[model samples]
Target: MRYAQVYFLFLVSLGMVGCETTPKVDNPVLGPPPPRLKSALKQQKLKHAEIASRANDRKNILEGDFEDSENPFETPVITASTTSAESAVEDTEDILSDSTVVAMVNGTPLFVSDVIGVYNFQLKQAEQRMPPEEYQKLRRALVKRDLKGHVERQLLIHEMKSTLKKEQLDQLQEVLETAFEEERIPELQKGLGVNSPQEVEAKLNEQGRSLYSERELFLKQQSAIQFMAVKAKATSKFSREEVLARYKANIKDYEVPSKVRWQRIRITYAKHGGKDQAVGLLDEVIHKLQAGEEFGVLAKKYSDGTRAEKNGQWGWTRRGSLAEPEIEEALFTLPIGQTSQVFETSTSFQIVKVNDRKEAGHIPFADVQGKLEQSMINEARMKATKEILEELHAKAVIETMFDLDEDDVNSTNSAGP
Candidate 1:
């Protein structure tokens, strides 16, 4: 049988034979078995024969033999003891082989080995930290993710080949190869802490990569990037009116809250023995401030607040953000460069100085025009890139080992640069 047919038969046999068992009667008088018992025995026999045949076919397939013999339905008589261990080994070898295709893009195959080779270092790390079952699950997820990326890259390359002239592609390839050798190699050596080309190759080998593969990958990425750059530039230009419209649509993002930068002196009741002592300490601090001594210096010398070590400097705080309502009110109401009169909260005696203040308002368009324009251009470029990929996906023939619904296909196509 063909491999797929054998697999289907094996599944059907398992469902029939594995689940059914012969039943015993209380006062049985049996010469031959009952009709139901006979049927069950026959099915059990067929299941074993099918399993043995499938195993033999699997062995042949692994050895690259697909030709039919004189008797195509012939089943090799397999001894249970010998075939069990041998079949297990063949099954494992089949799974581990590199020739299995996981996906195809425009008829170009992506093999199991390709996914494993590209991400071997990451897989090794995950294997070290996870149990065998968990590691297997993670490996499947990583392979799926890698296959999507590989398919997209293949699609892009296909688009480039179809759209670009052969002469232009040849010239671009030459330029990119020259750049890789002259510029990228030296930078790569420095980044990898290697001094020579051979050393760089050795380092990459340890990570399941090689110099040739690295260069090929770099070329592919740069080709796609350059192509996308040209396409995006053609579509990305935005008028001043468009930028202004985008900014107005997102105007709430530009509103700045009222805030103040202030300093404080706090004398907690617990730190100063009692409320009376705390009040007395605050009076001394006030006297020093009144005599032209610096508030920060007075705070450092006497305050028991958490920021005392930093001269009790409270950095710019937005309005109504403080837990203490009394302190919050005092911070915003105080004039710039002036200290508030001493006030008492339930836990402490406090004084504050406002260093600066900004009223609640929107940032003016003139101040952010250049940034807004650049941001709008970048957004347009991204949208253009997405559209290009979507168009390519619609045109290309994509097949994968796993099934994808429409939503999944759309999501894969819409993945950003």
Candidate 2:
């Protein structure tokens, strides 16, 4: 396959990685506000002053000083500062020089910091996946690739903004803010145990770092997929037939793993007179099971498990699924008709009777048709996005003059202080 085909295939396969394994999607910090509007405002203020001066000049000319050259307001046009525009342009240019400038479609002031922020996040991810020695070697290259990707995304975002309505932006902002405040923040705080507003802020700040990291991850994924979607639109005209074809080609990608329906009962060692006492109690429960008392009734009374009321019955066991080795071992070893001896887990003490077992099974295709269709849609979108980015890369005047030395971190642009 050609490089482009290989690239496209790699991008397609990337979608299959589990979200947990994927870097958390972090949103870019709105950051200290962009200076574009501020610059525009200052220019407007100057323009207003010039207009007033011109009006006065006209009055003076009408009053009799006919000197056109000396006129204080010769047409009072304040040329917007080229310097400011150039600075803004250069800031974006510098980043885009070594990276892909997707498109400044929306006229939003793109920032190097935003792309750099994203690059740092991807670097951290690379560091996590590789060994220390390999990470040190590959980190800069990885970061550069990430920056290239982000700049391309920024271009796409700019394009999207140009076409997208202001109300849409407003609606998106409102929805995201609601999610951040009402859902994400509260849940984060609850998990982190923040009580007061101050603690909440502090916790969020800590989480904010994490959030930013994840946002970069999210941006890459989103930008990649979006770039593909936009590309596919221009490349292969996707018809219902093509969608069906793509759907058929990638149907296996949509299968959900079989799940075992089961209930759990836990016996708390602390509640059952500490670990030693719990152990002794286990011996007694075993004896009762031998004597033929109903396992379910005894479990309801004695198991300190959260699901104790239901009985110490975990309905089924799927191979290689359970995290606890002891419980999993016992589940597989115990005869289907019998009960397990009291086993201690990291959290508590427990005895379980496998009231039933459901063998792992494949979900029927008809049952998952809707989900499969959505998967096809997403896949199609990705294909289109990749084509868009390839075009963007082809058109962009990217330059990577900056040295990325692995050994001399101090000399490299990527070096950390």
Candidate 3:
């Protein structure tokens, strides 16, 4: 039962996983468990038989849907190096006091301190390149999120295993391990230039030493995705109203920026002789403007820019956009119906005639409906994921003796570099 309990704990701890936007790498932000938890955890005393009994009793004890026990002080099987029970008990008490108990599934406790340990470790790693404040906040938020994800996955796995055939679970585990080792591990190793088993082992040990987090976060994330997909298929389906409601709720994200149209003529100093030829060309362009020749027509004939095809029309100019600073400054300054003298640049001599200008503004909603609707759908998917996790947390069986304050438990402090 103690081995079973330990195994269950291992599985539960493994269930918490971070988002998988990229490759599976060890997180440097999570350090080893606080010395107290590590020591007490090492000193676990409960027998394998007791834990086995608990696992068997789960069906009978947690009968109702969404039911969970409130007390978390259930005795754990400790296996510390020490033989003195008194020393182990004292160590456990100290660990519980400083630690934060978050949620308990069945009689197992999930400590806030444990989550923070991982979060801080990740934050420290990010701080190598990012500003301390920015990375810390990001790490803290991600840690809490991943912790919730972990707990929900544990509950889901327990429920699933209750019905899964022994052969089926074994087969799935084998497949998962093989996929990770044969496909993911090799790919990651190759990318990192770790060509040998010795090199891979050395790298993992080195990273684990500095960060104190196991490489298991990657496996947990993959497992969670699989479990979620199963749950979604068996439970509920997406609907139109849900989509529309989400779209409406986040409508502001859809607006577009206004644009302006204008025309210009450029004479390159590189093409003509130098300052003298540029000046002569500018004078001729000014003379053409006085003669009432069309600016676009002259630009099409003499302008050195690719925009000459559009009759020197730069389709739209948005404020603070990506145009050349000199061009932008000169364009915004020229009055309508005025022609400018030669503006010398390292590349060209330019004469700009302002045909017209339009002040920038927001784009109307109707004009951007398609983009807005897509954005809404993405937001809805994220919200749906969150709602599912919240639901799982609400119904989970949990217990804990960690003495963290409520504020500390809920606080979102930056983890610091």
Query: What does the lDDT come to for candidate 2?
Result: 0.49
Pick the winner on lDDT between candidates 1 and 2. Answer: 1
Q: Please give the TM-score that candidate 2 achieves against the real structure.
A: 0.33
What does candidate 1's lDDT look like per residue over 8-38, in tens digits?
3323332342211322343111212213322
How large is the C-alpha RMSD of every model relative to the true structure?
19.6, 21.1, 18.5
Better of 2 and 3 by TM-score: 3
- Each model's TM-score? 0.72, 0.33, 0.43
Name the better of 2 and 3 by lDDT.
3
Backbone clash numbers for all candidates listed: 0, 18, 29
Q: Tell me, by lDDT, which candidate is best.
A: 1
lDDT of 1 at 306: 75
Name model 2 segments beyond 4 Å from true.
Answer: 1-146, 153-231, 234-293, 300-310, 320-352, 400-417
lDDT of 3 at 267: 82
